[model samples]
Target: MNRAVAHPQQDGQDRPGPTTRLSVNIGEATAQVLQKHKARGISITETVRRACAVYDLIESEAAKGSKIQIVDRDGTTRELLLIP
Candidate 1:
């Protein structure tokens, strides 16, 4: 077996910094969405935050089955096929 080095044998100054990580390669359609957001004077960070919130909401909804009752209000039971 062989070992691999995770970092250089140099001081921390040789390591990459945080700003190098804050960049991403967004596609054309994603750029269009960002541009529309910019028209509303929103920063990229805000856009990403909003997107994450919406994603969480959608996933939660899909995970939770609706509480609606298909049976009549006369105390009847109904068969439900949950997409589990």
Candidate 2:
């Protein structure tokens, strides 16, 4: 089993924890968004981490009986689905 081991501290500074490598296929548009986030000073790993966090939050809310919807400025609302 692959394990995530913490990185050794250096220069007396606390750095980001070590993480296991994960391979995912994010399509072209998502890839562009990831790159954009990276360009804005966010690491690729961090970008992915934030995206995963958002998904986790959405799932948690949905499981709690919350209706997930995407609303547009024109007042159009569409229900979002999370498939396990």
Candidate 3:
């Protein structure tokens, strides 16, 4: 039998505890992305933190519309949506 141990907490670490009981329904696609990251040895908390940080950097909606961009599977850039 194999047992997994929790990683030890080191001194001077500033990691936050998981949010208090916030439940969200993640769709299948999102679950796959999270699973992929986990398989690559990245913690879900870190992935969520990185996502929130990038999302925070996006520009706010002014009188002009916000631009939405996406890269296609074939490496082409496409403007998918615009919202004012």
Local distance difference test, each candidate: 0.57, 0.70, 0.58
lDDT of 2 by residue, 1-84 (tens): 332233423332235665477788879999999889889987777766666657767787888888778779999999998877
**Model 3 CA deviation exceeding 4 Å by range:** 1-21, 60-84
Per-candidate total of colliding backbone pairs: 0, 0, 0
lDDT of 1 by residue, 1-84 (tens): 332223322232323664232578999999999989979987666676567655555455546753323466897976544454
- Estimate candidate 1's alpha-carbon lDDT, on a 0 to 1 scale: 0.57
Whole-structure CA lDDT of model 3: 0.58
Instruction: Write one digit per residue (lDDT tens) for candidate 3, span 21-67.
Output: 44688999999998899899877666665665445433332224555
Per-candidate TM-scores read 0.48, 0.59, 0.50
Q: Which pairs of residues clash in candidate 3, taking residues 3 or more apart in a chain or in different chains?
A: none
| Top candidate when judged by TM-score against the true structure | 2
Model 1 ranges with Cα > 4 A deviation: 1-22, 67-84
Candidate 2 total steric clashes: 0
